[model samples]
Target chain A: MAKLDASGFLIDLDGTVFRGQELIDGAAEAIHTLQSLGKSVVFLSNRGNLSRAMCRKKLLGAGIRTDERSIVLSSSVTASFLKKHYPLSKVWVLGEKGLTDELALAGVAMAQKPQAADWLVISLHETVTYEDLNLAFKAASSGARIIATNRDRSFPNEGGHAMDVAGMIGAIEASAGAKTELVIGKPSWLMAEAACKALGLPPGECAIIGDSLESDIAMGRLYGMKSVLVLTGSAKLGEPRLYEPDIVLGSIKDLTELAKEGILL
Target chain B: MAKLDASGFLIDLDGTVFRGQELIDGAAEAIHTLQSLGKSVVFLSNRGNLSRAMCRKKLLGAGIRTDERSIVLSSSVTASFLKKHYPLSKVWVLGEKGLTDELALAGVAMAQKPQAADWLVISLHETVTYEDLNLAFKAASSGARIIATNRDRSFPNEGGHAMDVAGMIGAIEASAGAKTELVIGKPSWLMAEAACKALGLPPGECAIIGDSLESDIAMGRLYGMKSVLVLTGSAKLGEPRLYEPDIVLGSIKDLTELAKEGILL
Candidate 1:
């Protein structure tokens, strides 16, 4: 196969760059090399708990120097999507401050109760209460449109794994007998489109590098971009490939070498 | 078709006898008349939040006189099932005080942490926290057996509908990538067996009456009992019957007339 000469790069955060608070070995150097080569790099994350500024700070702490503008989050994408579609709708949120803050900044009116809202936004929050879930259920049952940031079942954490928004979403859907209208995250074309717009490049010239095939690679494939699977996160070495990516690497550290060999020129 | 000629009655509470706090028309009279006819009346409920004593009290409040001994609850069945099968197991509970009280009375040791438990028991608890769900997820991912009290997605309440234990169970299952090992409630053979034991009759002579075809009618069909679907609750008039029951009625109020016709003799 010919070498993959990609000018734009979209990368996943949690499993690709680091796991929990520890940085994956050689990830930062690979990013630095990519930047030195003039590749447009955008760090993407499905985690909606942290703002773009907070995410940039965390990236800096891990020796990968990136600014807020280079970071794209699901929360931002969701807010933008809602603003474009339902600009004047009242939204009820079951998420953290980052998500609500983004929605608020987008000028979306927040509903105090589910019944008062036109849309219900669900995300992962460690402190989510039963009443919050019940409210979401009631609202959805009452015909409120439900939207989710992502559908990740679990994510890498300091402790083995932590429940992700998918679990909560499943619960709400089961109780309400309704499915979410939109999920503005990896594997969804909306998120891929947003990232592509941010990079100022067409999907054909960009490559998505991440650990999860179900999200990162799947999103890239759906958007007609080069999908690169890294082994630093969710996908295992021998697991069946549900969605075939353009390339596979043992870790993000190999990206520089692959570039040197003209494999990722 | 001949009459039902059922000698023992296994009735559902929430939808059949009462809707929220108000008694369903003719429900109390039907139960009283059944008792007057010397029929064995056992009230079966999938609600595990309340103890048998508490459930009996609620039945009394609805003008139905029933003793604690005549009530078979999912919590009590779960407690008995665990005691009989896993006598020396340490259990971690994600339920209300009623479930915990029942497990404690059955002499099951309660684990403080998920890691310390041999089994994880999940049910509906309005106050369940993310921490509780994470603990259950961790335990189940670590090979702990996951057992649920019931799997009702939503139950009838003062409001349109309230989220039931199914939501919690789905969340845990999605996070843990494991299905429940046992569900000791409606639609499950375990609960039907327990109810039959309480009525001191075989499944052949017992009739299961309730508002939900998914649970009550399904459970009866599973145990070779006469399934009677009542239209006062979850099941609607034209909904698809996944499992065909023996009989269908507009409401439990017609049970007396059916008895007079020897349909439920």
Candidate 2:
């Protein structure tokens, strides 16, 4: 079999670079080496809670220098999708500031009342109130199309796995008697498009590297990109695999050696 | 096939007797007449928000004279289930006062922290806060057994269909990455058993009356009771049926005529 040759990489954030404020081992050095070789590397996250600027700051805090332009988030992808497809629609949001801020930055119309909504966007809000859930339900049942940020059920947190947007989506869709019309993150074509757009590379020329098999590896397989599974996060060795990756690494730290081997050329 | 000769009746509330604040026509007369015939009539409701006392008050306002003994609610059923099975288990709740009140009334242990809980009970809470959801997520993820009050996605309200316990259940299950282990209400055998126990009659001698096909009618079919569907609720004639009832009535008002024809006798 031929070895993978990629000009750019779409990297996951949580479970890839850092988890719960703790940076992964060799993460900064690997990214530095990849950048030193002039290989395009774009960090991708399905988190609607972190805007690109916020993610950039966090990466910088971890000694990884990446501009906001190099970070692509689910919020950003959703914003762009809404801006292009639902430009005139009044969007109601059940989300945190990062998602709402991105939508506003993209010139999407925001609706304060459920009755005024043409679209209802869902994301995770750990502090979401019952009244807020009702509003989302009302907007959705009243004919607003639902757009979800991601399908992640939970993510590893300091305590354990914290509920993600999938919970919110599950609740709203059940109440609204409808399913989400679109999703803007991993495994969705929309997010794949957004990441490739940020890297300015074709799908075949890029590799998606992350710790999740169902999400990261699935996204790569669905979009014709080489997939690299790392073990720094959620996935473990010898676990039952639902999605297989083209390559496996102990962690993102191993990328430096792969770069030295001309894989990043 | 032999005709139904029920000695007792299991009646639903919301859609069967009333909607929002408006009492359905003849609901009071129907119950009064059934009681006059010396036949047992137990009001069965999947609502975890209402206790038997609260339901009695509401029915009183509707001109129906029924004691708490004649009412069987999901909360009451859940409390009984917990008291019998998990008597020593500390329970945490993502629910309203009705559910907690019933649990407390039944002497079910209550825990305030996720770590301290052995069971997590879920019910509808219109005013539940986000922190509460996280607590539920925490408890469920930490291996607390999930017990849901009902699976109702929505119910008829003043404006339209309102989101119900299903939303809460959906959110928690997705977040916790587990399905609910038990449901204490309609379509669950537990509720059927509760209703029949309240009436002090065998299932074959009782008829279940309500407007929902999936819940009420399905419950009757699952248990050994006769089922009656009424038109004064969310269901409509000619709709594709997922469950088939034994009989159909225009409304509860028609019960009086059915009573006159020896059906209630």
Candidate 3:
């Protein structure tokens, strides 16, 4: 594929900038170099369990330069999309209080009963119970459209790893036998569209850098964006070559090297 | 269908006893009434998230006479069936600890990684994560046999309802566009077979009673067991009449009344 004249960066977390609690090698320095070149960048993560503030705090704590607006968690994007597409709809939430709060802030009504809900939003909720899940299913089964944040399986937790919202969404899909209306995270073109809209740029004027082939590269392919696969996170050592990323490097260390050589700019 | 010499009682919970938090009028009394006839009765629920212990707790709390052993949750039946069929195999549990513990107690090994597993058992798990769901899709996509618990779209909780395991399984089916291996709970005939095996009785010697036409009456029809539709829970006053059940009653109370009137033995 021919390269487009992209001037902005849409970066993935987890494997691209950090893995678990540790920062990926040269991630902070490479991001700084990208900024010095006057490129607009947004840190996007499919982890919707945490709010944008929490995500920004985590990134800053890991020496990443980011602000609340510069960070877009999957939940935030989904909430924004719902607000734009279906304002005032009663939603049955299968997500955490953050999602519920976001929907509320977006002026959407939360329905107490599934049968009365106008729509369903499936997200990560730590306190989600069987009752909540059933309500979501019932609402969706009764013709309410479903909107999901991401399809990520699991993410790094303080302890090993925890099941992310995708699992919860999966359970609901199995029961309801319905597909979600939209997915506003990696592997879905909607994520790229959201990022482009947020940055005031077109899809062709952006690059997505991440560690997972299925998420980052697949998303790039879907949205016509350049994909840079980094090796410092979730991917196997040979996964970059196996998956055929446009640019396969050891880590952000190579990105900095490319910047120093003026090849990236 | 001719009435057979079936004598045992297999009752369904959720739709049978209550809807949401309100107990169907006379549902509790119906259980007591069935016991008064010295009949062997077991409450079978398709909700997979709750363990039999939890089911016992929920039912007893709802004023229903239920014990852990007499209540067969979908997870238990699924795990038990796997154990009986595959004595030595590693199972990738896409559910909660209850399912994991049950499979462990049944002498089945747990496969943490998807590639190491041969079979995928999809059930209701409160702790289900995106990782678990991804593994299920990947495993099933790679030709692993998929065994789901039930196809119930929604499950009743103390408050109202939650998504049943079938909902999540539906998502996997959508992604992979494949059918599941088996569903072992009500309406599938597998539940009837399990009941028959446990009681050492043939299908002709059993009678199925519940509040739903799809799960209860369908199983009865599939297994050639006499089905009695009770309208005290999920169904309306005349919903069961639409399915052509052998008998339709207002509740188990009606069953007891018929027995008292010497109309039923």
DockQ each:
0.60, 0.59, 0.32
lDDT string for model 2 (A1-265, tens) is: 2365788989998898887799999999999987888789999989887788788889999999988888889999899898998778899999989888899899999987897899999998878888789889999888999988888888777777777888898888876777888877888888888889989999999999999998899999999999999999889999998888988899999888877776655
- Higher-scoring candidate on lDDT, 2 or 3: 2
Residues B71-95, model 1: lDDT tens digits = 9889989999999989999998878
* Rank order (by lDDT, best first): 2, 1, 3
Residue B22 error for model 1, in Å? 4.9
In model 1, the runs with Cα more than 4 Å from the true position are A1-6, A22-38, A60-65, A85-90, A108-119, A204-207, A217-231, A235-265, B1-7, B21-37, B60-66, B85-91, B108-119, B203-209, B217-232, B235-265
Count clashing residue pairs in model 3: 24
| lDDT of candidate 1 at residue B167, scale 0 to 100 | 82
Task: Give, for candidate 2 chain B, the lowest lDDT window spanning 10 residues.
Answer: B1-10
Ranking by TM-score: 2, 1, 3
Q: Grade the docking of candidate 1.
A: medium
What's the i-RMS of each model? 1.1, 1.4, 5.0
> Model 1 chain A, poorest ten-residue lDDT window?
A151-160
The TM-score between candidate 2 and the true structure equals 0.83
